[model samples]
Every structure is written in C-alpha cells, then in structure tokens.
Target: MDRDDETSSTPPAPAAPARASRSRQLRLAALLLLLVVVVAATVRVVVATGPPTWDELRERAGLTNRDRLIIGVKDDQPGVAQKLENGAFEGFDIDIAYMIAEDLGFDAPEVTLLSIESEDRARRQARDADGSFVTVDLVVASYSITEQRRDQGVTFSFPYLETEQSVLTLASDPRQVASLRDLERAKVCTLGTSTSEQRLREAGANPIGRNRISQCIQALYDGEVDAVTTDAAILAGFVGPRPPGELPPATKLLRPKELRHWDIGAESAEKWGVNTGPVPEMRDLVNLSLQQSAKGPDGDRWKAAFDRYLASEQQYSNPQQVAVGRQPEPEETVEVRQWPWERWALPSPGRPRSGVPSAARAPSRRNRRSSGC
Candidate 1:
C-alpha cells in the first residue's frame, strides 16, 4: 500500500467520546449524591419529630370533627350495662374515650348499646374500613384478647381486667369437688359458646352445653346439674352474697385455679373476622387509651368498682376451708452443728521440736560455707 493510503487508513483516536462519557458519569454520580442527601434530611426531620402526641393522634383520627363519638357496647349482658347505668361508662374506659375526644375538641361521646350476639361480634368489626364505626367510634365491650382473633385483622388493647374460669356449685352439697377429677362423676353445665365449657372438656370433665351462663347457674341451683361453669368474675358477680333474704341459705363460690384468668381488651376483626389486614394505627390508639386508663385516677376508680361489685362476692366461704382446716403447727425446731476440720501434725523422730528448726528447714552446708558468714 502507498504511504498516503496507510496514513489515511490508520484509525483516529476516540478521545472526545471517552472524555464526554466520563463527564456524564461524574454528573450522574453527583446527582445521585444530592438525592441521597435530600432523602437523609427528610428522614431526620421525620424521626426527630417522632410520632404524633396522643391528643394529636386522636384528633387526626377525626374523632373531634364528628359531633359525637359513639362507643359500641354489647347489650346482651347486665354486668356492663348495669355498670353503665351506674355511671361506670362515665367511669374508666368511657372517661378515657371522652377525654380523648375532648382533647380533640369533640363533644362528650354518646355510648350506643349494640346488640352484638356472642357469635356475631367478629363479623360486626370487619364491616368498617376505618377503625371508626359508621355508627360508632369504637367498641367498649368486655372483649377477650386472643391471638386467633388478632390473626383475623382485629386490633386489641392491653388488658383492662383479669378474669378466670370458675366452677359454681351448691353450698349444701356434701361432694366438695376441688378439681375436674373430683367432678368426674358429677354433672357439669356451661354455656354453649363459652371457654369454660372447652376448658372443662380439656380437663376431661363431661360438660353439658346450655344456652347461657344464667341457665347453667339456674340448673345448678335447681339440682338439674351438679355444677355450673363460667367465668369466675361473672360468677362472683352473680353469687355475690345476696342481699338479706335474696338467696337461700345454701349459696357458695370457690376459685380452685387462679392461673386460668384471662385479660380483657377492646378488639375488632377486619372483614368481620374473615381476613387479616392492617390495624396498626387503631391498635396503637386503643393501646394508648388502655395504658392511660391503667394509670392515674381512672385506674383507681375502676378498681374500686370491681372490688365493690365482684370482689365482695368472691368472699364466699370455701368448703376446703372447713375440710382441710387450719394448718398443723410447724414441727419443733432442731439445732445443728457444723463438722470440724481434721487436725494434722507433722511426725517428728521423738518429741516435738521446742526451739530448734526441723530438718526440713535446715540450710545446705555448701551454701553456708560459700557465704563464709
């Protein structure tokens, strides 16, 4: 090839394109760094502020904008309803709800009694997309806190009170059954949908399911059943020492196991207990209310109410009190002496050394001679 053709065929360097590509990459990196800084600043601001205050959270929940906060309460029971009538709703839970509403600048909440059957409670809560009911803001029933229900997308607050399963029997009966084993031969009755019935079955006791706890208690009282099983707290309320002349001479209550007690919390299922969904905000709100209620004046007031109504009834005389009787006097105390350490003495050829050092303590003659002391 000619020298001119060779010079023309040699490829020109692509330095300009390479320099432009490097410059573009640097610009992109700088832009990315700027975005990271902006995002970091925004996150810092949000974290520094933390979540909204309880009052702010309640207000943001839109409770204040509404004319009234309606709380749904199950109407099938007399305990909660009776307390409501006696101004207990005006007491702890209700008072807390009202305070939350008032802080948000809303009117005192009006409690709406809803007739939610024991079986349908899960369904009612699922219908509301927001935590608020289209007809009420929240449910204040004596709902039990359970993991199975929680999995159904229901939010529950910390427990307000602790209740347990108890066996209710007649006061005059000679057969004092302290456990399920003791009641193996006796007839046990419980409500159809009650946990007490299930517990009895688990304990190996044959339980006859009835419609309501009241019916079971009636059966026990009338001798139709040997014992009635129900929540201890409710039983305590029912058997509360009847006002003079109310209950006959033969009525007593006992609680054999205290560990069976369960805590009560406010709960609502999503899709009516059909599906699990987000309830973090609602759960937080209820938990906040429960925490607040558990402390301060509200807690004391409710405790007093519980003591007055339920605790008094649980004071019934236990048959075991008469059977086991007082504990026998403790065995007389006995004195003990610690063992002494064994005494040891080194053996000497004859008598023990007086002033002379033993052979084991003698210095080497070679060392002594070398020292020339």
Candidate 2:
C-alpha cells in the first residue's frame, strides 16, 4: 500500500545531474558568442587601414599630381622627335603614351625626353639597379619585337605598327635583288646589332655591320656595301626626297620580297623591361594605358604624327603603305612646343599626275612663300 508514497519520497536523483549538464552547455554558447564578436572587431580595423600594394605606392610616388608624365624616346629622327617638342609629345609612340597618362588622369602631361639608342635600349633599361637615371614608365621609341629580347625579361605589348625589311639601293643597279638569297652575291650593310642584321644572319645573308643607319647608308652610297639593309620605315626616311640635294636622285629604296615583314610594339619585362618586380597589378595598369592610347584620341594623334613624318620621307606613296593602311589626315592639329617644320622649305608640288598638282599649288601660292623658310 505504501509503494507509491515510497517512489515519490525517493525523488528523482537524475534531475540534479540533468540540470548540471544544461548549465555547462549554456557556458560554452556564451564563450562562442564572445569569440565571434572579437573576430568581427579585428576584421573591421584591418579593413579601415588597408595594406598598400607596391604598385599603388610606386605609381603614386613616381607620377606627380600635376598631370606630368615622363616618357623615353630615341633622339635620332628629327621629324619624330619634333612631335614630342612643345607640349605635344605627338609622335605615334608619344601620342600613345600621352593618351594612357591622360586616361589615368594626367591630362597635359609633362613629357621628359630620354635618349635611347637602338642597341643600348636593353642596357639602359637595366640601369634601374644603379639609380643613375629616372626609371621610364614607358618607352615610345620605334622598337621592334624580337625573340632574343624576350629572354632578357622584356615583355612586349600588342603590335601597333607593322614594317618590313628592305634594301635601300642605288637606282642605277640593274641586278634583280629581291630576297635574302640574292644577297649571297651582294655586299650588304646594316646597323650593328640591329634586327636587320639579325634577320639577315638568320637568312644566311652574312652582311657587314655598321655603327648606325646613317653610316650604313653612307657605305652603300660609297660603294663599300652593295646595298643598305634595314627596316623599310627607316629606309623610307632616308630615301624620300629631302630639301633638294639632301638625298641623291640615284638613291632608290627597294623592298625585296624576302626581307619585308616586321612589327612594332611596346616592350616591358619582369626584371629589365617595364615589369621589374612581382607586381602584376602595375603591369596590368600599364598595359591598360597602352590599350587605351591605341584606341582613342591618342591613337589618332599618333597616326597623324607618324604620317606627317613618313609623308616627308615619301614612304607612304608606295604600294606597301596601301597594303598596310592609309596615311593619317593632314588637317588634324597636333600639339607641340614649336613648329619645327615651319621654318623648313618644302618643295613645291611637281606637276600633279593631272591638273590636280597645279590646282593644289595654286592654293599654296601664299602658303609656300609664307612658310617662313
């Protein structure tokens, strides 16, 4: 009869054990909430004072706030160099660089000219270790793309211009020299350490190397070398009619079938070129600038400058120019510090193929005399 009362009186000893387990679980939950709060606060602090990337500092420190951009250029061609004069820096390469800088917020960039020789470009770029010269952000020289250069840690951008290799020969020569094989019997001269020389060697031409293109041209003129082998662009500048007797009438530029294909592009690399370190972000930024310049106003401006210089050489009149592209518009205004061509006397148009030359001359009657030559 007392069994129910006895069970009730014993009470549940297991209840005390259950309450103790619940208390332990609650303590663990509170500890986990505290840890989560600490982690959130730490992340917020880190986000507020973000770590600076090497590229951000390098670009900001090197590039000033005043829209000043310094570019490297070769000092040889007057026409091309002239574009960089006056605030314009307007050559194809110069225009491209200026446009990139402008798009990056450096409008009216202050261009500081750096002289780069065809041979010494690699070495000069390698001079970053010594800190003797200011590191050039970009090089706008008429640089060619080559495989040997790729090994030197220089990266190349997409090609913006195409050119060919050709021989600038005496018009009097009757020999039908059209390919590198033809050069086996011909004495060929080229600038030392030039891509022309490299290509010739690759083709088994075995040409004599001169110090510069001017010297190579002179060697050809003196009969020391049968022909001057170089990029057609440079040869065009040399053979095109100059202010009267500057170039002889007998000098004729010939682009043989074999030595007729090269491309011009920007160069940079991981160690020696534009990319000196492991900063992919910087490389990307520079590449973007180059691409923008190639597409927009900068591209147009560069084409005009390139055309103006090339036109003076009369290179664009040939079939190759037609094959590649048309000349840039002449009416376009280009920026420059001074008009270098203003004082030079340009030859009056020879009788046009028809009456067009004469008609064109009529309009330039005052312009020719007023050119301040």
Q: Which prediction has the highest TM-score against the true structure? A: 2
Per-model TM-score versus the true fold: 0.52, 0.54
On a 0 to 1 TM-score scale, where does candidate 2 land against the true structure?
0.54
Q: Can you tell me which runs of candidate 1 are displaced by over 4 Å?
A: 1-49, 59-62, 72-109, 125-137, 242-278, 296-298, 317-373
Candidate 1 has which clashing residue pairs, if any? 88-91, 126-272
lDDT of each: 0.42, 0.46
Question: What C-alpha root-mean-square deviation, in Å, does candidate 1 show against the real structure?
Answer: 29.2
Q: Write the per-residue lDDT of candidate 1 for residues 1-373, one digit (tens) a residue.
A: 9999999999988799999999999999999999999989976776566555444544556644555545554422323222222223221223333433332234432333333334444444412324443444555544555677768655554555555455656656666555655667567887665556666776677789875454566566567777776554444434433343221211222332211111212122111111111444444555543443344233443454344334433344232110111111212211111112211231111112232112321111110000000
Ten contiguous residues with the weakest lDDT in model 2? 364-373
Query: Candidate 2 on 1-373: residue-level lDDT in tens?
Result: 4999888788555687789899989999999999999988976775556543323533554543444555565443323332222222223344444444444345442445455455655543412324456556556566665677768755554444555566656666666555666667567898777676766676667689875565666566567777777665555544433343221222222332212222222122111123212344444445444443354334564455445454444432254331123322222222212122431432111001111122211011110100001
